[model samples]
Target: MSDCNKTDFTNPSTFILLGIPGLEAAHVWISIPFCTMYAIAVLGNFTILFIVKMELSLHGPMYYFLCMLAVTDLVLSTSTVPKTLSIFWFNSREIDFSACLTQMYFIHCFLVMESGIFVAMALDRYVAICHPLRHSTILTNSVVAKIGLAVVLRGIMLVLPYPFLARQWPYYRTYIIPHTYCEHIAVVKLACADTRVSSYYGLFMVFCVRGLDMIFIAVSYIQILRAIFSLPTKDARLKTLGTCSSHLCAILAFYIPVIFSSLTHRFGHNVPLHFHVLIANVYLLVPPMLHPIIYGVRTKQIRDRLLRLFTHKGM
Candidate 1:
């Protein structure tokens, strides 16, 4: 282990992904449910964007941000599930080194991009409720476009370093990533070289991306709360609170699972490998699956349009 050569630092040309840990025998069955979830996630998010685009009345600040969220969900789900299903059904586990890197980059990139969109949505609600008269000028479509551009650029810049930093590190040991997905930190753990730099950068990226977004979102809601309370009647407060339910559902669904998954990844050494794998997979899958459903059910605009599109029914 002490002996180090130049080759020790060379990137492994390929890697094997170990699908679900103890459930190897049941991987085929497991993939059935996994595929169903992925189908719903992809189709659900696409539906959100499709309805938003089709219905002119749905064209507004909130729905525009919803479109961005749907796009991120689509990217996030596709990046992992297709390869994951292949590994389960076809026994295709070997992934090219570059492809693995690309997957890791997109996973983190879209994950953070999703978080950024949530923050943007929170800000949208804050402006809508807190400063109602100024909401139009404040959250104009042009401004939303600028925010979307910033979010995309931010995610790209933050996640870009993961691959570049890992590419230079030599892998003297095994190239088998234990997790089903090639997450940034999980893959970084495979490098034989000193990975402190990349590890810390990954942590920083986590804080900059997820942590900062969560902070801003919390702050936005706090201001929004005060504004809602200032309303003259309880009905007004309740109605305002109701408007935020979808965003709140999304934040809780994503952040709670993510927090547990991160903790298990960093600290849960005694935890079963499958347990860790399950939480991580769910962390990614649940939001995309639920976000569109929550919005469709909770937002009258989307639900009405979807119902009309489906049944050609009612005024």
Candidate 2:
């Protein structure tokens, strides 16, 4: 109701984000874990990026997707970790309206880009497995570059409406985002004007992008399975499947929680905020944190290269 007043809303130039409730009582205790996760997320993704770039053997389409994913993970985590950590350490949760919108834009942009990358990775796998004879022709260097550009453009286009819709709300006073990050829906909730159109559009976009990505991934894997089944030798099948294992695991880890959170947010609003926050954070942070480890362990060459790099640096 306080946000409904035009004068009061316009007068307040900044708004505070009330980060995860109950943290105020145990800030010091929470800081240790939060800081540790933040460090791991950043360092882990950076290490993956470094390893991918340093190892010349990983210069193929597979590792290309991995590198792009690592970059996306870095950008994704960096978009929110700083503010989340600051809330715990400095107890400062206030954010300017403009800054809030900026953060929301970048966060959503990277997220959609990540989704696009996943789709592209699926296509890469499809080519490698289902149509090996033409894999090189289908997923060439120039094609990968074009795919990367398309992903960025798609992400920007999809998320552009969020900020535009947000700016049109002339009566948004309190900017107390319930969650730790500048999620689009969370920011839209602060709008004094009716957000039905924006919310519907956002939900539609979420489903379309994520849905299409998932469907394509599924179709790719199905074809891959068919192709593997037709192979005469067990060794060939195993080798082909082995190449896809890490990607399958990464895709499952990333999409499961995201789909779960999206469903809960849309249909399970009756669920407690604690449950929502837990699911949302896991969806955002856990996949990125786990992705590098998954790939490193599954790919022997990358693992060995990373070990040698760490050994040389005495880390």
Candidate 3:
């Protein structure tokens, strides 16, 4: 082995990120859509936050949870997209070792927090639909604040170990990450040491965060469905189910991509590298882009308020 190869840059001062293994030539073109999606995510999520904060009528647990989801989406997408854009636009791919870990931490941190927010939103829907009379009392401001704090803390605590564990491994193999960002598995895969622990912990974190949250969301929806079906009139059932459409769409948009990306990363060994990278990028970008659109279009209150706000400004 060459002396350079033998040298243990236990932790390389910096790592090089290959935008997309085989698609570097098309990076400029690919960035267009990614940039657009990110723009929408930023604009739409901020709009949700602003509207929710200003609209007295939207002062409720449901809107509060929407605000949480919006913020999480913003952080989650922001964690990766700007760097990816720089790589595409300026060929800037060198990320500092600590910065890589910071990116990984925020990416996973807000991701888990987003999942928790989804669960909280699911419960909010369950209460509003299943126990209409007690919705306000059950999800009062105090309880909502507590849930938000718990969600934030849970994300911080659960993902806190990712960086610590990854830091232990010596990246002696190669510093060239063949993807846009410092994805935990991607970064750790370069480490010369045995990675079974980090890999296993990552899987455990996924199950504990996404899997368990999914199960809870599923159960909440089940009860919600039962409550909807129990209603005496078809119209009543439809109206109640309608109330959940936005949340359902948001959940599907968020989790389906996440599951697919995680599975492909761990198990889809046969999948092409570019395809995997593309899917991963899409998973991060799509939810944030679609979330506000879903809620704005499906939630009548938001849609109407938005229309009125725009119309008033136009006039």
Candidate 4:
């Protein structure tokens, strides 16, 4: 077994993030759309957090989970966009090796954290839908805290090794990453060492966190559906389904693009490099931007409160 720590790194000083290889001429034009989307994502997720804080009535398991989601969205987007935008807008692409690794660590950590929170939110929805009477007891403050801690720890445990692993691998060639962000795969691909171990470990972590959680979430909803149909009244069914609409949309918003983007990148040989990078960027950007909008539209409390908040300022 070759140890990466003992290996030498060629050009160990800095890495160049080449923003969209062939489309370098259009970077300024591209920054417009990217910057707009980033602004909306930051503002939208921030508003969700602020509203949750202001509305004391929202101090429940459902909203508490949403708060966690919002915070994760904020951090997740923050991990990549500013640096990405800097590259696009200013051409300031040189990053110190350690800083690059640090950025990569946070990006992977926050991404896993975001996915874990969705699973937590799913369980919250399941409890609220399937066992309404016991929901409060089951998802108590203590329980929520425990779940939140677990989600954070899961991210920490899984992602901590990624940067360390990448750092140990010696880079003898170009330190230029073609994409906007410092992803584990992108960075490791530049290493002179064989990446089989790091690659497999990353794949395993993805399966454990996102894949397993997705499976559990599916089962939870299946059980929730069974419980919902067993309700005696039509209003009860509609009311319960209404409560789940926002969460269901959130699930779709978070997963659908990721699945599509992942599939295309892994399997689509004919796909253009720029197109894949763009799709990948969208996968990260769209969720946080849509989180508040989806919840605000589907949730009457958030919608009405936001309306009141704006209307008050006008008066």
TM-score (all chains, Cα) for each model? 0.96, 0.93, 0.97, 0.94
lDDT of 3: 0.92
Q: Indicate which candidate wins on lDDT.
A: 3
What is candidate 2's lDDT per residue for 148-178, written digit by digit as tens? 9999899999899988888877655555778
What TM-score does prediction 3 earn?
0.97
Which 10 consecutive positions of candidate 2 have the poorest summed lDDT?
3-12
* lDDT (Cα) of model 2: 0.82
The candidate that wins on TM-score is: 3
lDDT of 4 by residue, 177-256 (tens): 98888867778778877889987887776666678878988998999889889999999999988988888888888888
Give lDDT tens digits, candidate 1, residues 116-154. Answer: 889999999999999899999999989999999998998
* Clash numbers, per candidate: 1, 0, 0, 0
Quantify how close model 1 is to the true structure by its C-alpha RMSD in Å: 1.8
* Alpha carbon lDDT of each predicted model: 0.87, 0.82, 0.92, 0.84
| Model 2 ranges with Cα > 4 A deviation | 1-12, 311-315
TM-score of 2: 0.93
**Backbone clashes, candidate 2:** 0
